[model samples]
Target chain A: MKKLSLAEHSVRELNSALHDPQAMDGGTEWYVSDPDGRHALACGLNDELQVTIDGHAGYYCAGMNQHATVVVNGTVGVGVAENMMSGLVRVRGNASQSAGATGHGGLLVIEGNASARCGISMKGIDIVVGGDVGHMSAFMGQAGRLVVCGDAGEAFGDSIYEARLYVRGQVESLGADCIEKPMRDEHREELRGLLAHAGMDFDPSEFRRYGSARELYNFHVDNAGIEQGDSHE
Target chain B: MCGIVGLYLKDPSLEPRLGELFEPMLLAMADRGPDSAGFAIYGDEVPSDQLKFTLQSAEPGYDWEGLVTAMERDLGGQLDWFRNATAVVIKTDSGEERVREWLAGNAPAVSLMSVGHSIEILKGVGHPRLVADRFSLSGMQGSHIIGHTRMATESAVSMEGSHPFTTGLDLCLVHNGSLSNHNRLRLELERQGMTFETENDSEVAAAYLTWKLREGETLTQALESAIQDLDGFYTFTIGTRDGFAVLRDPIACKPAVLAETDAYVAMASEYRALARLPGISGARVWEPEPGRVYVWENAQQASEETGT
Candidate 1:
């Protein structure tokens, strides 16, 4: 594996190297040391490569990723794996807001808590948070699946559409149009497979599902406010 | 865009190195804001009822020598004064109203920065590094410090427009986002007899908190009121006599991260500003939740006061 120390190299150089597959032809792999919490590290990657960040990262780490398996051994700042298209991005520690926002594909596994707006406006990404997520998570998310192993913050799944939310813990509140739905066998199987993939021991039976009630998709003159919701749980 | 960084030392052993550690935290945000920079250092308690006030003037031709001696003679109090670049610190046991009347009646051109038992605010219009050097912020020692680097949105790039806005004793606020309801709120606050230093929305935010706290609201309670009354996407760190606090708007569009360890409680616009701090690797790092207040008081002082 290739080794680059952020202390000696700028974050730009690391990203440039990752973008070009030829520079990584030896193995398409890199081990980044001493990240020291820099922003936009390993961003805009589109190749099938293995990149390991050994320490903490700052904003937008591995953002806009495509077909890259990026791993961080320490905590991540805002928007880790934001707008990813494919492959896997995992954080060993906590993540900040907007993780996997507007992402079209791929899987984001955060072993620790993610702050507000995790999986916000998500398109097709699969997100698994091992700990609590802050408020407004999955806001207006159109597609994909979000599985939370711990409690969720206020207004969870606000104004969501299509995306499936599976939480094994308490949800503080639901947002406009979001509602608790019966956990069917299909969703349980999907969530179970995801837990197995993340190497977590969890019982699918302990999880509940939430989604859009589909009442306010279009302007129904009856629904004339922002506090609209039909949550059962 | 704006950048804010704060360091509140939980360990007394790190008190002397406050400025040394805070400089890099402020400078790392050079990209977030390049127009101006500022910091509020809380230290050197007066050990009495006397209050310290930091004042500044933009006119290089302004006379600090004439102003200090004349102000002393005018007030006829035991005034202690000194100069640091364009800033002056005046300490007196006199009341704030008396000093205010004196400044208005005497040095109209000079602007007041802060008034507190221990806090000293120094700010200017320049790059973060240059501003820090110009004000000599690298050598000061304090128990806790709050700073800002500003990219102007609603105000000009003057020293007055720079952040770490202080309106109350031992109270200052640095903001990372704009407020949409500032004009209305400013007018409402003005009706309440609160004067403003600049047209900056952040000043309104600071003043609002100051007003709330002055009316017997705790820092957390005042921030809770802000979450309801203020309309915008903002992340604010407020410096107080006891400690500092972090808060964000309910929507939480603006970015803010906080990390706390046994040694310190630090907050920054991004994790990069906090990466270099001691023991941050093992710190309990997380984003300040939307509409929630996270406050860290000096451990030793709190324990002493509580007799714990």
Candidate 2:
């Protein structure tokens, strides 16, 4: 296995080097020394490459990613794996704002607390935050699963769509268009799989699932007045 | 574009220490304006004792060196270059009188604007971190700071092209919203020989305000002029060396949230940004009224100057 040291290379050059087919074939494992705790490491990858960031990262690390496995050994900044379409990103420490925002596919597993607006506008990404989440988590979320093992702040799952939210601890409040739902056997099994993959051993039965009630998805002519009431209510 | 942030303590406010924390706060808005970031820190340094000047030529190759040399000969050792650029900055000890004399001597080709000391500016390119690291921004101490985060939709990003542009030494400006009538204003400014550095709408606002100030309009008068002339969904925060002002276009397409406390005043592109400040916990926060020009000297002197 070859090793590519990003100690000297800029973020652009480091990502570009990883994309080269020849560099990938050499079994190169990239690492950074003067990581400078920058953001957007290994972002937008589409190949089956394996990348590892050795230290703390700033915002949007591994964002909009696909077909790659990226691992961060330290804390991550905002929007990790945002809009991801495929592959996996594993964070070993706390994540900042809007982790996994608008991700359409793939999985993001954070081992620590996530800041406000986690999984906002998420499409299909499966996000597992091992610790607490700040306010406005899952805001305007469209689809996917947000699994939280700890407490949630205010406005959890506001304006949720088809996305599922599973929380083991207390929830401050639900946002607009969000309500609790029964976690069926299939959900339990899926949650189990995610836990095992993320190396967590929590019980799925203790978690609660929240999703959209489908009350605000489409406009109805017959219910126009009711919709207006809901708008202000 | 780049992200910009600033804080100010208008008079009668005792939280003058808030100006010391400008760097860390502005760093958070980096994503909005990653192309370049800078702040004009207005400290206890009073503008009354100094002359503040800013210059831009209507023609590109106007003789900046010749103008500087002549101003130096006139003002002598009383002159200080607070900031030197392809344009220029020269402070005269004679205050506004020396500045007016110098301006009166220059040709119409050498467009210049000067005012009482009250403005400061900081700028550079790249992400907020890059700009902060390059400038060691966190250490700055000032009475206020204003900033912008750029996405570069309209102009090629560069240090000169970046914003928080000054009309005079005392007044600095930052913008977030886009202007629709930029082309028309750009043409007008161009025909007037305001050699524009970039195709950014923000630049038009800067030049237009400068032109208005050159025409002897006060800060408030110049802003009212902007409300009349500039079109589009724009929001801007203007910081003079002594005071600060906010304006939103009639449509209010952009987001700007302000939080005021006895200690300091803060504003940002989103409520989330303003809510995240450290000492501003529980600060009374609200979005600026659409189409209104909100002015403040600090926490104590805030008022709605205009509205729809």
- TM-scores across all candidates? 0.92, 0.53
lDDT (10s digit) by residue, model 2, range A1-233: 44445566778987777666775675645555444346678888878877888766666889989988888877666678999999999988777778999999999999888877889999999999899887789998888889999999778998777888999999978998889999899999989988887788899999998988878845345655564448664
Q: How do the residues B1-308 of candidate 2 rate in per-residue lDDT, one tens digit apiece?
A: 23445566643343444543555556667766677766565653644656555554435466766777787777675766643333355666765656665676665554453344645454566776665665455655556777776777767776666677764556778888678898998899778766565677887888788778778977677788898898886788888656688887764556565667766677766433443455554455444655567777534565677644
Residue B189 of model 1: what lDDT? 95
Best by lDDT: 1
What is the C-alpha DockQ of each candidate?
0.66, 0.03
Residue pairs with backbone overlap in model 1 = none
Fnat for model 1 comes to 0.81
Docking quality of model 1: it rates as medium
